[model samples]
Target chain A: MRRDVFQAIADPTRRAIIGLIAIQAMTPNALAEYFDTTRQAVSKHLQILTECEIVRQEQTGREIYYHFNPGKMKEVADFVEPFRQLWEKRFDQLDHVLRKIKTTKK
Target chain B: MRRDVFQAIADPTRRAIIGLIAIQAMTPNALAEYFDTTRQAVSKHLQILTECEIVRQEQTGREIYYHFNPGKMKEVADFVEPFRQLWEKRFDQLDHVLRKIKTTKK
Candidate 1:
């Protein structure tokens, strides 16, 4: 299967992992403590994240710390940025319609 | 599989579909013309997007037009907005470090 940042963040657990590691790096064992799953499952998710380069692993002694690569997340952010304007426009239109309805009611 | 905005936009083709429909509503047949896929394939992608409420279908006579629902994408935007600060901080730190390296070289 192809691994990309989009696929990396598609899972809720992986998003949780990103939220945690974005603050600080963690080993699979440490990350697993926060989830209701096994350490192995956490590791599997980390593996996918690493494959997509969303997280990078660094070996310090026997433990591998997974660090969130903010650069990869920039791609996801960039993808969503353009849509922000579209949504805001829709919201603005809705607000206008609501204001018109309010004037009619008055 | 659970359909969410993230999963809906994971595929490149689906992202393309969103971009095109954002400008103007299009039927699956019209959308397929932009891609190298059959109308049914485009409809399958549209199905996932519709399930996630990222796109809505309006039937005008025999043709069904898919309109991009910008509201669903706001969820995606909200998810990535917090991380924007993190990446910006990292970029700033990188710029600072680069300036220091340049000073040392000089």
Candidate 2:
């Protein structure tokens, strides 16, 4: 199943995992070392991330390193772009209003 | 209670509501007309949005209009900014690799 970037990032733990992988690719074992949770739990989070393609695996012979795939995050940025534009416009409007108030005071 | 923009946007319905109000400020009655759901249901979505302050309420005399607050969306954009930069860097690396491959082939 294709999961959205939002679902992939919904959990704080998953978000942390993404953050870790973004800095450096790590094997499942290496990635698990930083977390207090059981390795199995960490593996489960990786599985979810993998399913969403937020994390990609690189194989070198027997070694599998998980790397963060930042491109997948575009889904999120695309979805939020309209909202962001709208927000900036609102801020501009507010700025104009504030300027008008200052001018009136002056 | 303060809510993160991620939580505010998790629901598809809520996202749609945000999109609607972003274009134009609308009252509960007007916003409800677009959905198949009941007026109360639309109001519930509006309530959740209002609580998060993503939809700010403007009261003029007896009229209450819900307007999309674009400022709140910065949380989502901020959280994803690092990931976006990472993605772009990776793309540049890929482009470099592809050019190197072509040069080698030549």
Model 2: fnat (fraction of native contacts): 0.52
List, residue by residue over A1-106, the lDDT tens digit for candidate 1: 8688888888989988887787678999999999899999999999999999889999999999999788888888777766665677664555454344334321
Candidate 2 local lDDT, B17-86, one digit each (tens)? 8777766789888888888888899898889888888888999788789987777888777677656656
DockQ of all predictions against the true structure, Cα-based: 0.31, 0.28
- The number of the candidate with the highest DockQ is 1
What TM-score against the true fold does each predicted structure earn? Answer: 0.82, 0.73
Residue A104 of model 2: what lDDT?
33
**Candidate 1 global Cα RMSD:** 11.1
Docking quality tier of model 2: acceptable
| Model 1 spans > 4 angstroms off | A91-106, B91-106
What C-alpha lDDT, on a 0 to 100 scale, does residue B74 get in candidate 1?
A: 82
- Candidate 2 — which residues are off by over 4 angstroms? A59-63, A89-106, B60-63, B91-106
The TM-score of predicted model 1 comes to 0.82
Name the candidate that leads on lDDT. Answer: 1
- Mind giving the per-residue lDDT tens digits that candidate 1 earns over B58-98? 99999999998889988877677666656777745554544
